[model samples]
Target: MHAKLGLFFLFLSLAAIAPLHAAEPAPPTANATDAASGAPTDAATEAATEAQSSANAGAQIPDTLEQRLLACAACHGKQGEGIAKSEYYPRLAGKPAGYLYNQLRNFQEQRREVPIMTYMVAYMSDDYLREIAAHYARLQPPYPAPAGGYPEQELARGEALVRKGDADKNIPACSACHGKSLTGMEPTIPGLIGLNREYIVAQLGAWKTGHRHGAQPDCMSQIASRLSPRDVAAVSAYLTTQRATADSMPALARSARLPIDCGVVPGASSADPELGIAVPEASGESFGKDGKDSKEPGS
Candidate 1:
């Protein structure tokens, strides 16, 4: 009995002195997470996996100018073409950079009253505006053929107004200031072609309502004021149908003086009707003080 007791004490000492070690690896994936606690390991594994996934997602999204442009793309289109399957969005691609720049500035300054545009541009700086404008101006996307049909009589009237104004109204032809083919003049005037009919109508209405504004004389306001609803509809539809010719591109230089003393034009006279200043009436045959005429090559 004493020998057995002595052997038992020896065994106990041996058990205590044996090098301590962790328990055998817990049963596979099921018990690996919490050997001490009574909980499943898979939940912890899933949580860790989720955390890793979140980190990867964060890493994938880096802030960039391209990211900022996404906001513009949402409304204007991915390429800034402004053709987003919507009627009101105009074709912004390949527009004159200066013209685009001015419009962006107008939106930001609230001079042009587009609520969405104003809100989007509220925080954009002048330099950023120029950048965005330049980006769109550089893109030359293909223009789709004009859509929708109008009455032939209205179309004829529209064409007449675009090419030759009604002599009775003292209004000059649309081509006189907007290039011979209804394209824009550099540094200010926008191209009339490749624009949505609805957009044109909307802008004309805005001008008529004094919601849209430009430089001192605001020639658009004056021009739109004289237009009847029929005239506006006719002109907008006609202009949209016409495509730009080689010469339809915006003129780089202000080669000729404006037909009337338009404040926005590069070299206009003091013919401010808005400021109570008297101006000369424009005629199809002749315009401005010099007999340069509205149909002159430079004009």
Candidate 2:
């Protein structure tokens, strides 16, 4: 009876030990292969499965417009307010949607040539470009303070040129197209405020050098060509000193025609009574065809 009890206990011990051995993971040996065929061992297959799972987990980021546009915030601010004192990047916030759209098209078409900009828009469709433009146009963050340190003479000249043009030089006042307050006119023209002098100068220089182009009969190119180096400097200086206010929002569509024909502005190239477009005023007085002085905000 004692011998029989010892054998039964030994059998129970063997059973427990067998399961423990079976539960332990098998060590993979060199050139290990499946017993049925010459295929990779289960250990290799398990490792591959684990790697694939990790890859799938890494790809789980949400695909959204905001996520795609995170790259833009690197150069332009999160709110589309360009970097302060950056010469190349300008504020996109609160700009007219049409103007912003045209610029994206320009970059895509190589009419404007910033290498990075060109690359960014290379594969974008027109609708996608419009969406991007609209996104930035809707942003209205507070602007950084205007930079100063320009000479008084230059500032005065700039003010004169901006408010009242040099008739003898055939230079129309900037306000004629930019609005009396120097806030941009709606649908096309961009605001001149909140930009650094260097950026403004660089743009004018680009136009002069034929490095930039807009729609045919590009009025900016014409205007830029006519400006002397000193004139450009004066205008940039004055524009950089002005502060943006609550009334600084873009002006409504022009009641009077633009001082010059701009391809970007709808119906600006010709007078279409149906479109309510009028002829440009040589004097840059912002007067309508009916001889009414069409005043703008803050005028």
Candidate 3:
């Protein structure tokens, strides 16, 4: 009876030990077939998944047009007033939609030579350009002129140059092409009002330096070359200070004093009753007849 009891106790101990061993999970076996097939390991698969996630995040980094335009508002003002001191960015508000659209296209196509503008426009499409232009054009122009005062004498000088040609230099009055009010004529020309001084100076400088070339017989280039540094400064200063008045009359009159009926002739008026110029119907061969090809590269 004593031997049987001892054997029974030993059997109980063995049963407890067996359960302890059984509770531990078995070591996983590597499948030779999977290894031979060269399947990715769990760690590698995890790493790949993480890399893909990172790539997706990177791809989403560019801002949408609305966001970019919002960023533009900081420097350009809420309504595209343009930076007061920095003339590099022009006031986009109140510009003709077609003019704005062309400029945006020019920047994107590298026809315009501004590095910053090129980058800003690089990824933008035609539709995006039109949308941005339309948004800005619809905004009302800011009321009241810039607070800073411009020199009266300089302003007078600029006005004189713009209204009356410096015949000695063969420089025609800017109004000859830009119109009496300096607000550009319809369908092509752009206005000069509300522009930042820096932009005006830069554009004039570009024309003079050949950095901004236009198509054949570049009018701006010719005019810019004739202008002295003082003239550029004076003109820009004067223009920047002037405010557009609602009562201001258009530059051209119903009748002009030019000898020819051609559109290219200085002082020639437009025939369109609405244009107030006596300009003859444009013969199929006018300078800007081909709208797409009219502008010079980098204009």
Candidate 4:
């Protein structure tokens, strides 16, 4: 029994000394790789994967107004420059803010009847709409090349209509309200340049068919109603043939009273009978100036 006890003590001393003399092999970790072999550890691999995923997600959904408006780029363009191949979607860039704002409200209020526009803005607040309008209005992109290829006679007729009114038909010149440059008049009217011919034709037709509406007087509707199909074509063709330049910006303000009363246009009043100019009577209102020679006002 003495020898056995001595042996046990010896064994215990040996065990203790064994650990002091040499290290034991470590247990493998849950996430481990051979560092000497330069292989990536499980934790490192997972971290890299997570980082890549975050990068991809960030790319897809960046926080910016321009990025948020990507859906609009599908039709209108990235900067509201408009889609060149499409005649249906008109350019929104560089248009008057008030005009753009009005159109947005019109879509929201159902005064305008474009399903896509109405749907896009259905849930947007007035302030949101105004922001969108301002964004597009501030952008001034390069205009597309003027479209051509109309017969000379057709262009001539269009020019006559634009430059001088048809006295016999009591039709006022387009420039009378659109400005002499045909760019537009400030505060409301939109520039005619860079517009697609087909788009112009369609809008005029919409006005004529009562598919579109404006404010009380609805002068555009009245004017469109008086235009024949042929006249519409000529005007669109002529407009497309014209180009816009730096000087083609909308006029700051009207120098004189509008030849016709346009309810949407602030301060537009009836023509003076003293000048023998006839204008359409305002809706629920008559001409203030009295004259002996009376004529019909067509658009």
lDDT of each: 0.56, 0.60, 0.50, 0.57
Model 4: lDDT equals: 0.57
Q: Which order, best to worst by lDDT?
A: 2, 4, 1, 3
Task: Please say which candidate is ahead in lDDT: 3 or 4.
Answer: 4
Of the candidates shown, which would achieve the greatest TM-score relative to the real structure?
A: 2
lDDT of 2 by residue, 1-299 (tens): 32233223223322332122111111121121101122322332343343346446876434445544544554465677775421234688888666777787787777775655665666666666667777987888887787789899999999988888788788878877777667786666788998766667767777777777877658788887778878888898899888996336776664456677765553444433322322333222222233222121011
- Sort by TM-score, best first: what order? 2, 4, 1, 3
What's model 1's overall lDDT? Answer: 0.56
TM-score, candidate number 3: 0.59
Q: Please identify model 2 stretches exceeding 4 Å from their true place.
A: 1-59, 85-88, 269-299
Report RMSD (Å) for each prediction in the order shown. 26.4, 24.7, 27.2, 27.5
| TM-scores for the candidates | 0.67, 0.69, 0.59, 0.69
Q: Say which prediction, candidate 1 or candidate 2, comes out ahead on lDDT.
A: 2
> Candidate 4 lDDT, tens digit per residue, 105-146?
677776666654565566665555556667887788788889
Off by over 4 Å in 3: 1-68, 85-88, 143-152, 245-298
- Per-candidate clashes come to 0, 0, 8, 0
Better of 1 and 3 by lDDT: 1
